[model samples]
Target: MIQALVIDDQEINCILVKGLLENFFPDRIRPYATSNLAEALELITTLQPELLFLDISMPEMDGFELLQHVRKQQKAEVIFVTAHDAFALDAFDHQAIGYITKPIVSEKFVRTVSRAIELIHQKTNTGLVETLKKAIITSGNNQDKRITLTSQKGLTFVDPAHILYCESSGNYTTFFLVNREQIVVSKQIGSFVSKLESHSIIRVHDRYLVNLQHVTSYIRGNGGLLVLINGKEVPVSVRRKNDLLHFFDE
Candidate 1:
């Protein structure tokens, strides 16, 4: 049986999806539903379901925030369920395999769920399994401090060590990693600097947040640039040059 968990602020939405699972996949899926985020989180921790149907907009905790916690603890494949498609881009950025728009279409839900099942069987989800594993430790007094980044499909949990650099434009930030690949999220560079300050990540320019661990060589001059181990050149702002030097020297 496929363990499935459905979370939505609306009780009706939860009921509707659960009903669909029962009627269509009665033998295949064993589903559980909750309209409360707190209760949902607890169930997720205890049940450790293989599939998640999460709503984006909620009262106190949105799906994105809850996902940080979910991705931290479990290896469930997520499918975002929402009333509108406004956050579709953000959903995809987070690595969600499917996006089910509300007033739920039977065909789309079934198709997406089928795809989720197909992907769940693939080689333990490859890089994502290890990525999430290192990024989120759900043990006693969790030790590793990892950053949860928004991806093209869902929220991506990243170990600070895996990051190469971040380039931002307008309201979006694109993360370039050393191992997996590049993921573009909707947040700007300013939002990430605070989260990464303790780590080796530093904002060298308005457009860049480069991981100091990945800096292979620093080419100096007026507004000098850095060469990352991944072969990418990131520019260092004139104003932040002194700060970078202090950080390195320290």
Candidate 2:
């Protein structure tokens, strides 16, 4: 069972989160909630929970302020719950697992919590490792040469030339190679864009980060489709279509 905690200023909000956890997770998660920040701080130290559902609009110190205190005790997968969308970027900056807006929609809550659980599994189990795990990169003469991919099993050094494309699922990115080998890493596709951009890797879609070196053909459409060297077809989003075309033109 996973130990989880919910901290909210409103008693009703705390109850709602606790209820939702019980309904969705049932036997998987053992949840505790508190409306008092002081009590919540004590609980963080005492429980040392693996999952935390924190509210951002609490009195005195908000969720972000509380996170500063919580981090000192232990590392927990934090999902920020708030009615304000304004803090979404800040929450992501703090590396929170998920940011949930107020008046919790069950479907959205389930989806967000499901992702948090997946990340937790990745951290605790041998799944995808930690999402913040660094990808050591080597670049020479202003060119990216290699990327070190780390996994629970071991580390694998990959050459940019050999990479075909990368696909993103939630927080994980899977690198597909020319040899049909796949390396899964616990990092977002956006994290790798700057590192691999010099080596002809680019984001063609929200879910796809591709190495343009391996693109064999481009089939035109609204955003169009890309035919890779290995005969894999990848979608090109309309937003990034012009950028891709410009790359091709160059």
Candidate 3:
């Protein structure tokens, strides 16, 4: 049986998380629930569970403080369950498996739990984990300058300038970088449209978002295609051709 622990200051929240996990997650989650930080710390020491559900804010001791203490003594992947959306980016900084926003919607809860399970099964690579920890800590100073992507493994730091293009395939979105590296995310393409648009990345087609800075040439005819600096040809819908040209003229 896989061990799981839920730490929340509110008794009801702790119980609710525990119940949700038991129902949505497979029977593998053998849950241990606690509201007291002292008791929770003791349980972490004793149980050393493989997974943890943490709340960021608590009386006397907060979630980040608890995480710091527990991480030093044990290695458990955490999925933060908090009422505040502000901590979501902070959660990625700590290489958390996932973040659940306030009021606890069941569908969102299940989605986060599903991602956590993927992390458990994938066995996060050490190099990538280290990269993420460093990226997260350093990211606070560069929030306005850089964008970070959080996934099952960890966080990836991306410079909008180095991005070549983004491609969508169903639920997955792939980021192609200037260094020839690709960061494949499990989120939908539209999810990233807003975050990247301001950086000069524009949607060329439903399946493609190309960085305007990386467009080397445009191959015309048959709806045409964009040749990126990296040599990848991203399609352009004929209807969007005028918009693409208008963007260039701006």
Every model's TM-score = 0.50, 0.53, 0.50
Candidate 2 lDDT over 1-250, as tens digits, reads 8899999999999999999999999977899999997899899988999999989987889889899888988889899999999999999999998988887899999998888886776666543323223222222232224566865456676888899999999988999998999998887889899888888988999999888888889999999999999999999999999999998888
Question: Any runs in candidate 2 off by more than 4 Å, and if so which?
Answer: 127-250
Task: Identify the runs in model 1 with alpha carbons over 4 angstroms from their true place.
Answer: 124-250
RMSD of each: 11.6, 7.7, 10.3
- lDDT per residue (tens digit) for residues 80-129 in model 3: 99999899888889988888876889998888777777666545454555
- The deviation in Å at residue 148 for candidate 2 is 18
How high a TM-score does candidate 2 get?
A: 0.53
A best-first ranking of the candidates according to their TM-score comes to: 2, 3, 1
Model 3 has a clash total of 0
Give a tens-digit lDDT track for model 1, residues 98-167. Answer: 9999888999899999878766644344456566656556553344466666554765667888888999
Write down the lDDT of every candidate, Cα atoms only: 0.85, 0.86, 0.84
- Angstrom error at residue 105, model 3: 0.8
